[model samples]
Target: MSFPAFDAHHPPDKDLIDDCVHCGFCLPTCPTYVLFGEEMDSPRGRIYLMNKGLTEEPMNDQTVRHYDLCLGCMACVTACPSGVQYDKLIEATRGQVERRYERAPEDKAFREMIFQLFPYKKRLRLAAGPLRLYQRFGIGDKLRKSGVMSRIPARMRAMEALMPELQKEQKVPELTEPVGERRRRVGVLTGCVQQVFFSQVNSATVRVLAAEGCEVVAPKDQGCCGALSTHAGREEESLNFARKTIDTFEGLNLDNVVVNAAGCGSTMKEYGHLLRDDPEYAARAKAFSEKVRDVSEFIQEIGAVAERSPFAVTAAYHDACHLAHAQGIRKQPRQTLKQIPGMSVKEIREAEICCGSAGIYNMVEPEPAAELGERKANNILKTGAEMIVTSNPGCMLQIQASLKKMGHDGLPMAHPMEVLDASIRGESVETLLRR
Candidate 1:
């Protein structure tokens, strides 16, 4: 009853596997390797397993465990000196794993629940109603103090811990005119989790773009960018979302498609490769991808036209892994933040390492994700910054939870767009610190 390691459908590419020189450059930057020091958790080690799957062995529990442990942070892709495409390799490998392997019933059901809930905005909004009441009534704290939390599944506990305080939903208009002459026309991706839970971030993004003389169009019809599904290797589901996204903004004739969230931007930028097999969308996906830009990246490119008011504060800036490693967007965010009149941006140690919120990794793999989150939180504390600034909602939630555990709960966290928006609108520094 032995089976081939991979089926006839798209497996990990043999040529890409051979591109790894095994030079060990990616070892130090890998979060799992840094945490466990296991060779099996490193990128080189995973590539080795991938090679074995292709030639020597069948896909088994051990092999799949190693692959599942990957955060898909793409730090290895940034660290590799040989230019090995670990991003493509791991993506292909995960897709194969999802298709070829069967999971335990509970594991499959849990993953199914995540995929079902996370990728839809309306479902998430509906779920948020209950979460708001839980936070307001302090049920989460009561459950933990009563020791009832210990009885819950680890993944469920992790999910509960990572919930951010829900606020009133801020809706973006279908079209917003520039403050002055329109320099560029851009369409924005109001993401799923971002739209439901972190709507303020989207509102800030639109305001900042408008203030900078850009005609901003946020199509209400747009849905998930498929970042979670794509990262988790639900290939067909991801492709479907990608095609819908492409279709949403296709006829708008915009200068750029702006994405504030790092995870969504990374996956949206890869629609071409993800849909390369689709005869109808192969070319359209590539064209749509070409116009995709991270909000800070877009701001940096267009140059700042709005006046920046002074809001003096020392801030720790976290480089979201997808923005930095997956898209090579290291400098743009820093440069954008520095544009503010009196802002001081401090860098975190091990900036290249992940903060353990790679899509849903923190929820599914709770222990490792917690370890990495605490490690990142400690690094942030050393800077003594008054606030934390990052571009991704997931990173914000992960870091906030870890900092809360460390009793630094008073420290505020904000998206870079919010900071910029506050400054541009002459809001007081207290406005940001109070958040």
Candidate 2:
């Protein structure tokens, strides 16, 4: 068998690879393995390929293909009894693949476009202008109903369909004071796509934080947290972005840097490790990382001071992989949401399985992402909930697209904070749905 040439830089750690006992714990939890029943797509199988790539074997095209298929959802890490650090191994292997492997021209172009646009808030906002116009004019709806959209590339159609109705951006202010007494001061991350598309979530987050006796500071200049690039194996690029984020948030003597987006929160928490080698930013990165917390996690930790008014809605909670699997934050969000009176938080089937919105995975790997979205949507429908509550913008978009595809777009979804914010403000669940 022919293997691709290897670059010694960013080699997969032998110790981390060895930690995978190959006892099949990760196989059942792996999305790719679940879909194709292919051993090579499983965690241990990928580790084996990483080992081969490190052992002077050519990291052939097929090897790169397997790694590309991985969602990097870290479900395997959550399932493994042995505590195998599959996250580190996969990330390191991805860096190697980017450095040593060559992709098809078209695939390379699509990836470059994503890397260029999605990680920058200004770029995403600028790009959304046309999409907003498309959605506003009902062009997308007409095209889809007439089957013309299907004629477009599947990924392109999927991208078009995934565009949420972009409203005027609700920019988070530089500082928000608490309603009563300020118990703590925190920094909020206004993510790239998040600030543009789901700014409502950020607004709700700030309101909820203030209502809970916290002073929130959202740095106007904060950029992407490098979750997308890091997950994709663009190590150097991700590191640069991480450094910028670290610098932006470090200026505030924040007791906690609150993050509402699951992927951003996960990457921010790992900033210390991502920039551990940078002499200038290493210690600062570690210090900044120590203060990072998922909004739900932070809410639960500090305790919600505001009284939650009743919100009458049956809601299915979809666990974002980064929030649940990556950060072990399954319960905090649920616990925070349950605090709302008259709210029913139903558990969906396969709650631990990824909804396949792993950063930009839905955009790049639309086929598998669509399948997983369908699976998640179906399971969500089974709960008979009026709304699906999740913590990540990616999950919100993916689940909404899947529901639309399944002819069930009537069901509205929300970030947990939105629901909580509604209850706290005595707003009806209808207001949330209408928005």
Candidate 3:
């Protein structure tokens, strides 16, 4: 008895697969390809595997391993000259893999635990309670000092290392009035990990938007934008989250739906295609996607109106892969940062390479993720900047962990919104650095 490689639901599209011209342009930008120099790990190589799976090849451990190694950072989309839609191809391929391939018991359970925990805010917060205690009491440091970390599994250790210092949660109001005159009305997506762990980024985003003459609305009912699930190829889960998110902000009359996190914005902007099969949400999703904008992109579109006080710091700007490559938003962030008086934005080498924080890639594939993170950290150090500015929380944690490993842990990392908020609020450079 023979079986087909992919089930009947939605196999990777042959038309899309044929679009890959086997061009080597994606090699340098691919994180796994750059790290291992493996053809199967590069976008072109993976597209070949996907094509084989579509024909005679069956889905097996080897094929699945190659797919699993992909970070889904979409850097290839930016690098490709033929404009291949590798994002859609890989996403469809992963969905097929998740449905058809049987994994080892441990691997299956680990993936299940991640999906269960990371997408839900409440579960994450509950887990954070103990983690906060661990960080607060310095148990994490003590464990590191005692040299017991070596005994732990690499995945668990990666999770521990990526844990950012939890600060007191800063809540955003459901509605915030514009400072001077209302120029536009916008609804914000307060993301899952972003809200629980990096709430300050959301708060600062609201503040900056309001100060810039935008009446900001943060619907408390909004949940995960499904970037994690979407990237991981949990098709139904991601689409469900997408439908719920669309429903939450649908009735609110707004000029734009703003997002701060790079990953979230990229996923939210693709809701139309993600839900195109659904008759109910296909049209609604398209409308919603058009309004979705990265906060920096939105601000740049509207033009910054608020006065910027001097923030005297030379900061290296790390372009989060989702923002720069996935969304084609390379310049808006730097342009926004340059608006700050006395602020200099230095660019990192290999600006297109991912920092090993492609959603939960670091947590799942710890070794490769660490290699890329260290590589990114080395480039960042070469910039000689006082602080690091990026738009994604995952990048913040991954880069911080890598820098710590290199004994440069004191280097400050911040979101662009936080830096912009400090400049607008007239906060001292010292105060901003401490944050």
Best candidate per TM-score, number? Answer: 1
Query: Tens-digit lDDT track for model 3 on 153-234?
Result: 8998999999988888888999999999899999999999999999999999999999999999999888899999999889
User: lDDT per model, in order?
Assistant: 0.94, 0.89, 0.93
Judge candidate 1 at residue 323 and give its lDDT. 96
Per-model TM-score, in order, reads 0.99, 0.97, 0.98
| Tens digit of per-residue lDDT, candidate 1, span 1-435 | 222688767788889989998999999999999999999999999999988988889999999999999999999999999999999989988998999899999999999999999989999989999989999999999998999999999999999989998999999999999999999999999999999989999999999999999999999899998999999999999999999999999999899999999999999999999999999999999999999999999999999999999989889999999999999998999998898989999999999999999999999999999999999999999999999999999999999999988898889999999999999999999988896
Q: Global CA lDDT of candidate 3, please? A: 0.93
Give residue 58's error in model 1 in angstroms. 0.6
**What's the distance in Å from true for residue 2, model 1?**
13
Off by over 4 Å in 3: 1-3
What lDDT tens digits, residue by residue, belong to model 2 across residues 1-435? 223445666577778888878899888889999998999999999999988876757877798889999999999999999999999988888888888788989889989988989888788878988987887789987997898988998778778878887889987899999999999999999898889999999999999999999999999888988999999999999998998898888878889999999999999999988888889988998989899999999999998889999998999999889988899998999899888888889999988789988988898899999999999999999999888899999999999999998999999888999999999999988898887
Error of 3 at 26 (Å): 0.9
Off by over 4 Å in 1: 1-3
Clash pairs, candidate 3, are none
